[model samples]
Target chain A: MEIAKSLQQTPSSYIREILAAASDKNVISLAGGLPDEKTFPIDLMKPTLETLSEMPEVFQYGATAGYTPLLNFLTDYFQLPDTHIAMACTGSQQGLDLIARAYVNPGDKVVMEAPSYLGAMQVFGLVQADIVTVPQTEFGPDIEALRTVFYEQSPKMFYAVPDFHNPTGVCWSLETRKQVAALCEQYNVALIEDAPYRELRFSGEAIPLVSDFCPQHSIVLRSFSKIASPGLRVGIVSGKRSYLEPLIKIKQGADLHSSVPMQALLLGLLKHDNFDYHIDTIRTLYKSRYETLYSELQDKLPEGCEIKPVDGGMFVWVTLPSCDTFKLAKELLKDGVAVVPSPVFYPQPEAAKAALRLNFTNATPTELAEAVSRLASGLAKAI
Target chain B: MEIAKSLQQTPSSYIREILAAASDKNVISLAGGLPDEKTFPIDLMKPTLETLSEMPEVFQYGATAGYTPLLNFLTDYFQLPDTHIAMACTGSQQGLDLIARAYVNPGDKVVMEAPSYLGAMQVFGLVQADIVTVPQTEFGPDIEALRTVFYEQSPKMFYAVPDFHNPTGVCWSLETRKQVAALCEQYNVALIEDAPYRELRFSGEAIPLVSDFCPQHSIVLRSFSKIASPGLRVGIVSGKRSYLEPLIKIKQGADLHSSVPMQALLLGLLKHDNFDYHIDTIRTLYKSRYETLYSELQDKLPEGCEIKPVDGGMFVWVTLPSCDTFKLAKELLKDGVAVVPSPVFYPQPEAAKAALRLNFTNATPTELAEAVSRLASGLAKAI
Candidate 1:
């Protein structure tokens, strides 16, 4: 059977291709947005794992929304108002898919930062959404450009990652958060606030989620994959009941519901006394790795190449002097390092500036240093 | 926010509404197609659950295809051809959903029996497939009608449940299976064989899957939800590598694969020494419940009400004298029994015959008898 027209339009993920190549034993991969396997809070989850056999009900089919205990807990955990609710999904990735499926009609305009979460772009692309882009500033999205898009295009939704963003690690400033939220409210476009890296903040205090300023006009996709375990494939989506009900309905057909055992396990871990401390440890560990990658890049990158320090999250973005990044990435891989070229993060790859996204959370300080040496030497020759 | 136009065409699941009402303690519900909670082999799964913490690899991000060990085991266990492969999904439900999303474009002709799986209709509806239906018979689909549809419409695929089919529990006769396979091959139509209840046979010898006859032209969906635990949400889709890759691509955006821990847990349960015996016990238990409901309906059902005995699977369909099944179902609920009305099962509700799908698995023999009592009296009043 021929694949759907929609699937044909979706570019196979470049990161997946590079990651496949990066698996060579000699290569040190900073190409993937993988949380270090060692950082998984397996010990914190052990008590729940052992107790699951006793909870036979979890092994039965679950409510389409989620397991009740988890949903109830999340409503309070996220401080959702009576009008709002929470739904558990296979992952926040699925939550994003649901949003696109539920709300994005073909040709509907969906706004996003030019370099944004690739998975988000994938989902919206599958629905054949007309994805419009705005530039990202150090603070957040280029707010003036955003206003012009909203005013002219009148997009259905503006998708954003306000916490330590994937690829860029740019946390939206509080002022930017409020401004984006206000613009959303004014334009009546739904705000899809994706915060997969919220708890990974290492050096900076947390800023309010952009959704907080316009809760009535926003939906929040929160993930435990970073602080908890992605292998469990559990995440939470929250918004006003009216906003979330469509997603819940779509979810019923998406996967029935997420794994109940995973949900129950997540609830147990959340209730554990040391779960908060577990997040702290992930932050400290990732912070150290980020520092190692940052300092190494700063020292070795050729003049005119630039690097930015991140307060938290998995990646450091390096702005290279204009060059063919795909070729550079391939050459760097031959030198025993793997990184994602910036074009893969853009909806229109040709519009992307010369840059590379290097992940810090999945490697050690020594490995990070070696990868940078390979990257710098490779880049110096290319530039 | 208004839902997308695609979602707008999809009907809200009437089953959900009836299931919610069935939750009343006073109601003996046969409305849901739930396996008995007692059937879950939690004890058999315990050893794996307890040891999951020791397997840190299962707690990290896994391949989008599935957990490696589980995939390898299933590929071997199913005895798939060298060119065939297995990929795990959130459930067979997701397997169906992915097939629709990956292969069916809006207005693509997809074939199914008139009264078919609601979830299949749901996923297909979400993708705007132009569903074409053939009438079903005691043997399987009406062979003449199926042939006419396939030869004339040339649907992209024929979606079927060849064993102990849902709603009707009409396990196809061997001849019918072969005939359907021949028609699919002749028409060059893809066969989507969904076999969630294939293993639940208790009274008759098992028949070969329709896919066995049309292996090169089919994709098979196998579910453990009935034989194992639905809460784990693990199911397998297998076909030639070319046929399965598109689904794996769409699946990356769907949920980035099913939960890895759930996949691991399913793998352990499948490998347990007593797993086959556990299935035997479920078969025996459901057989007894089916007998009780079948006999009670035979003795007490109103004149003109017709019932069929099922050898396996969860439900028995009762065709009634021409009347409104929705009204009959509502009256039965008030009489303290809950059953799914036949109309709810159809893509076009008005085309459904007046019938009720009574589940025998979740309720006990005693409860099944009582539910039939309520159903009989309510039917007598309605007719």
Candidate 2:
């Protein structure tokens, strides 16, 4: 059968193959971007679940925009500007997909960081966007390079993770965030600020959102997947009404609306007085895990290998001196450790073949220590 | 800001405007495809809710393919062939959207019933497919026209709701179903069999699925939205592994996966011995409601109006000889009744301007009677 040209262009088998290998019972999987399930607010959710069980409306269809209470609560919680509108999504992933569908025509140019979120890359690619990458310089997308891509390609959209970016765990510098906003505005490009990890700060002060800098041109994507519960699949996309109106319509055709019970559960949690306390608990747990993974990698990785310090979020990215991370990832499966090779994150795989991403949040500290030792053993063989 | 050409092509304001009017407190809505909230299996779900409350895995990230247990259960329940694979979707709407993304390339010809599910049309439009619609006869799409479209346009895909099709309440004759399957195979076109309402049959013998006739080239979409709980947002798409493999990859970028807790709830219900009994109860209730609507419309509608006898599903489609349903829908809103104008269902609105769809399942018999009276009054004004 003939498949869509867009589907044909996606990186279909590589990630699935790695994920399949990671699923082996003997392997310690540090590859998946999953939050630690132990930190999920089971106790806190009991009341909400009980209340929802009695409410049949929780099991009925919701407005395509979202459950109204959740929409209102998120709007207030985020302190969205007067010009903005918020719509709930099945997940932030759906939010990204909707944005791509609403704004990206086939072959439209979409700019991104050198190693961006593979999920977003897949969505853009499925829409048949011409994905152009700007290098990341420890902080975020290289702003100067972003300017050049904007002028050269006149891309329709620029997607960035402003805080605790996936795979790399690098937050944008405040100045870079401002420059990105300005560049998008100057080039008349839409800025997609994906902030799934924005609330996951373990160190450094909070940075102003890219949407704050370019409220009119930026659409900020947020999710409960990291701090609340990934399995519930609740998230939101907030932006100027003009952009959001199209997304809302596209979302109607996407899934009609998000799961109403999940939306109600989230609404109940958000409305609770102790919601912030629950988030604080999650932050403390992830922070400790991050520290454990950082120290273990520092002690175990080969000399000349580089590890970037993470301020927050689940992953720790490492750059090997001379290794093929994809090949190493496969070899490490035999050594009983699994990490995501960095090529999956890049629009062009050959551009970054030596880095790998380790997810520290899902594994225990003891497992992290053991996993790092196994990774080191595999790296030794590869180098 | 510039939007995608596809989004621009969609019917953005028309449906929303009607929905906004329907939402007024004074309006009695026969417009929405909502199942009655009172019929939701809250009592039956108590055990499942209790079980899920204790399972932390319910709140953790699920496999991108789906929760494994649900996937296995659905595959078995559907009695899919060994060559097939099943993947969970947020809902069947997402299933449709994914099929379009995986198969319908830009300007690729897609054939559908003239008055089909507007949701499917929107998804196909968002992908910029050339939508060539076949006219719907009472028994389904006109087989002769479908064959002509197949031979002439050589469409990439053919989307059909084989049983109790939306907005039309038409089930395909057994021969029609077989012919649709054979034609799709002969033309080398993928067939999307959306069967959300297949199980809601209150009359007539069960018709074998289109996939039953042509399993290799057909993908069948099933949803719990009609039979179980719409709010939970769980559905499955099953087809040959060759076709499903691409959809599974596209689903990875769609929303990662459906909500895990929702999947578990559905799994629990499907496993219970009383599951079929619960569906029987829904069928009985909807059948009575459908009868109520049919009778009330017969008593109230003007001379020269036509109504199809629904065998199952929530809708009763009406055709008026001298009235425009869109204008009548607006005028009826003033009399406190709301109905979905059928033009939205047609690819070309001018072709079906005199018909409308009324949802019988959500409203009570008394409300259905009252809505018909109000509709009659509005029709009087239009005539």
Q: TM-scores for all candidates?
A: 0.99, 0.96
Candidate 2, B179: how far from true, in Å? 3.1
> What are the runs in model 1 whose C-alpha is more than 4 Å off?
none
Q: How many clashes does the backbone of model 1 have?
A: 0
For candidate 2, lDDT tens digit of each residue in B1-383?
Answer: 68788888887647768777888988999998888888888777778877777999989888887999888988889998899989889899999988888888779998899888888988898888898998888878888998998998888888888789898899899988888888888888888899999899999898799889989888999989888899999989899899888888888888988899989988988888888899999999999989988998889888777898978988888887755777778888889999888889988888874888899998888988889889888886787
Worst 10 residues of 2 chain A by lDDT: A10-19
Query: Model 2 clash pairs?
Result: none
Best candidate, lDDT: 1
What DockQ does every candidate get? 0.90, 0.79
Which is the leading candidate under TM-score?
1
lDDT of 2 by residue, A1-383 (tens): 77788887876658768778888888999988888888888777778887777888878888888998888988899999899989999899999999988888778899988888989988998888989999998878888898999998888889988798888999989888888889988999989999999888989898899879989998999999887899999989999898899888888888989999999988887777787998888889889988999998889898877898989988888998756777778888889998888888999988885888999888988999999999998887788
Candidate 1 lDDT, tens digit per residue, A176-285?
Answer: 99999999999999999999999889986777788889999999999988899899999899999989899998998888988999999999999999999998999889
Backbone-clash count (model 2): 0
